[model samples]
Target: DASGVEAVALALVINSGVTLVKTIPLRRFEDAVRFGIGLSPVFTVFQVDDQITSSPHIAGPTGDTRLMPDPSQTVGLVASPGWALAPVDQLDQDGEPYPGCPRTFARRMLERLAGHGLELRGCYEIEFFLGHRAAPGPDEADPTPAHTGPAYGAIALADVEPFATALIRAFEEQGTGVMQFHPEYSTGQLELSVPHSVGIAAADTDLVVRHTIRAVARNHGYAVSFAPVVFAERVGNGNHLHLSLWNRNGRNLFQGGRGPEGMTREAEAFTAGVLAALPALTAITAPSVPSYQRLQPHRWSGPWACWGRENREAALRFVTGMVGSRPDAANLEVKSMDPAANPYLALGAIVAAGIDGLERELSLPDPVQDDPASIPARKRRSLGIRQLPASLTEAIAELEKSPMLREAMGDVLFDSFLATRRAERDVFEGQDPEDVVRAHRWRY
Candidate 1:
């Protein structure tokens, strides 16, 4: 207790993009880690509304799983003194890897990639709106921006600088690199980017960074929403993923090679793989009902099925980097993703899709020069461009049909994931868009 560590939080990022937690006092931390903290299997299907939904393989209160903390990544919460947090690995009753754990699924996929002498350096861009409750939304509590400054203006930065400084310091203290932190285009929206790491570590850092942001925001008396859509009419938050495929020796595979824009043959194949899976990947990257509100055409949300160099409207925006940066700076960004996605599942599924492409020696199609939506329908069709799933129902339906994803996530996990998505789809069958936006504005 010398560090005022009275309690420790054991966090499990679940399938529904919720961080389910169990806490233990510092005195029992050893016990908890040694014997795991107990929890129910029902959390696998929890909805944004906190209602319990069921999958055929997992339902009722008949089963139990344990959460084992990975102590190496445990971090002290600077904003909330007297506490620390650990991301957990879920374990079955018999102490086997829990089949439903997204982290485990991600680990298996990363391992698969590693076996092929390829790896991913990835980071999730975190974006959220800072506001206070102004009035009731169409069906839930509505919030107004805390700052009056114009979007991305110096005034906006000045208004939030004190808070931003504290956040940057907190991130540094927590061992998270702060690449850049700034006010974004949306009212009261702010974003933070961290340096990339190995795929699994990148996903872990995402959970840590998000937890830290929420804690720091509370200390500053501000509300934060990581939801995909906080308002029906306004531009919404989309947290993109920046990733690069690399060899084990740390050489960037996307630079200094024969393929278009300096991409190696393998790099081109991997990029093509991700592009091909855009339709199926949206189910994991933009999974929620409100996600559809933000995934529309002309919003720079990458609602189309294509890739481009520096094209924000392309689902996969390939960053070839500036002249001097060369090999190291090259990367690809998945733009259709948002805060509603579970970090582990999204990273894992994307890597799995890329791996599939690499194995098949897939070829990249022509990168769109302009917005795919701006392209005429006939032109889009001629260029092999198509809109990605426009709704969660379509996304999940696409997800259901992906044998690659099904195989990547074992049969049990795949079925449970689809079951949860379908269950949420039914809950939101006819809800108004604004209502959907309000419901998830703070759910994450």
Candidate 2:
């Protein structure tokens, strides 16, 4: 509640797969903070077409509203006008918990892990593109790339120095620790790595990171796109997750000399569960039609559901500890995620899968040492390695059949989530490839 604050933006992650924001002027923000803000329950079932209301929740003749407060999230918009994020909780008319709430699901998952004397520690490694807005064209596609050169070239980083500087400073002010920033393989593409945190804080930091980057880029007169693919022929963007587990006494549970690749027994079990559920998890982790375009072989987008040591092509890569960092630096990287995913939901599902493995004492498969694609097809099949869902339709079908994931997410959220994804599929199923990419280019 800074005196200079002019507005508070209440943010909610809705079923449409984007953060929905509602702004309140400074004068009214105090009241909103005290009394909470009113929101329609229909938001949980909102489709691309406002007129097409087909969800079971909407089948009833009557509708209801709820009032939930703006929880305390990272506050940093000092570089922009006086603005900050106001995160809200969705509830029922009687003020009961809303089943489709992503944050609630994440919290519950964290609690479940805690019950086993373990905690989740991780961060999202975000990749995105920066460019000018597209000039109006017959096809209405996004703008052309802002720069072109070798990936990680010094010239590419120098070209975006001003915007990058502002973004880093803004993130610092908001309490997000910037570990590294560099130009990526695609033209105008960049990647940012933030320091990891425990449990819910990691997702909260992801939100702050996205908001800070977008706001600072806007101030520099540049548009940032976190879409899976900004251009059809270029390398696509991915929001890879670096995950690990820890004990309450501050010990890294993923490190040990007894298991495969120097991993601990706990780490092996957790990784096995996530691999077992990779096909179903894809629908939630890469929730957009364009996301499938990025998950192909040889692009390092985790095309196959197999775990390997330092193998980028596998869905889960077991990262080794750095020379100085030792056991503390070890973690698993989940590469199938994209920016379009709701951080809370993606993380929640991941933790649930890991816990399932831990509880059931699941065993880890042998690690893939060579490039999985180069391995003979017969050998790959015998090794139990399988390709992930190549299309959104296939991913959705896999999710629908997963009894374990459905039970984890609960009936209310699972049904609503499926309905929303189906609606998205209906809208983009037959559209041109470039057109589909354009439609999702800036929304994330």
Candidate 3:
């Protein structure tokens, strides 16, 4: 084992966005990798709560698959000694890549884009809340924020300096790039973003980085929740996605072009496609019940299905970067998504929508300069800005209408994903917002 690693975690992300993992001892790693560890296909439709939902394509106890860890991207965990993490690909008994595999779906999307001489560089910006360990008792009080300083204040950074500092070291030592990490707008909530990676690695990084955070936090006697909403009243966390398009020759397509904010026709078309598909995309990116609480208007969560330059309220916020840095730094920020999403499936869906835009040569509408909701109704309608799906139910309905997204994910994946979503909706039906938020508090 490299670095005296004792075990390796074979991690897989299912349609429900939960990371289901199996670990193997170092001595057995070769056998596990070559022959794969058996896993049931029913996991494809597991709920966030671990309840299984059935799909016509893949369900029940009749099917099996193998989880083969990717050795190329395996890494020793600096935060958790004697361990390593490797993302896995699910292959059916026939040794064929399974249609229900989210990771494989993401790779296929990237391959599709590569065929057009294009590529994506993307990363996840994760926000999470930290809570102190709860005392054991029947009358145990509520878990308190690990830090009491004002939100986003310097005092907040100082309060959690020890844990935060360890977090930084863990990331650096593990070879994970840390672009920025700091206090966020909610009490005990912190946000960190890593440098973008090309292809499925970005999605892989999302899982490993989150694992590193949880391990370091436990060592510091704190609990971590990447859930959309930790409490009913508090502002929820965001898993904002930052992405950019580039060509094989290393040119940034988002800048130095004739379209809006120097976007090339391809870039503009891609943006338009994403904007038009926000309603449908939510079924993948913001799949949780409490996810709606974070997607509300005025939360700066970008509930409006529109775009603007550096506008946080816009679903797609275009960043031109600082003067003279446009070529290297330009990217788009998707503010509506949260950590509850499966990044692989989310990224693939986003790319699929963008591909549709490019194929149709779609044009982006005029950017929303103000909050779309605050604008006069007539003006908002004229600008073509509409609020995205308000609930998981509505988002699922929109997804049902999207043939493009369904085709992108294929029938097996598409059917199983919907099955899980519908199961979640039915399970949480009639639950109050506070109850819903609490149920999802530590799931991710």
C-alpha TM-score for every candidate: 0.96, 0.94, 0.97
Per-prediction CA RMSD (Å): 1.9, 2.1, 1.5
The pairs that clash in candidate 1 are none
Best by TM-score: 3
Give the whole-model CA lDDT for all candidates, comma-separated.
0.86, 0.81, 0.89
Top lDDT model: 3
Instruction: Estimate, for each residue in 158-271, the C-alpha lDDT of model 2 and write its tens digit.
Output: 889898888888777666768999899988899999999888877877777787788888898888888888887668999999988888778787776588887778888888
lDDT of 3 by residue, 1-444 (tens): 387799999998887778878999988888878889999999998999889989889767887999988888788889999999999888988899989999999889889888878999989999999878467454444579977658778899998999999999999988987999899888789999899888888899999988999999999988898999887867888888899999988999999999999999889998899988999999898998889988988888889899999888888999899999999899989888988999999999999999889888899988777878789888788878888998999999999999999999999999999999999999885799877876677678
Candidate 1, position 296, lDDT: 88
> Where does candidate 1 stray beyond 4 Å?
1-4, 134-141
- Deviation from native of the Cα of residue 11 in model 1, angstroms: 1.0
- Candidate 3 is scored at a TM of 0.97
lDDT of 1 at 245: 82
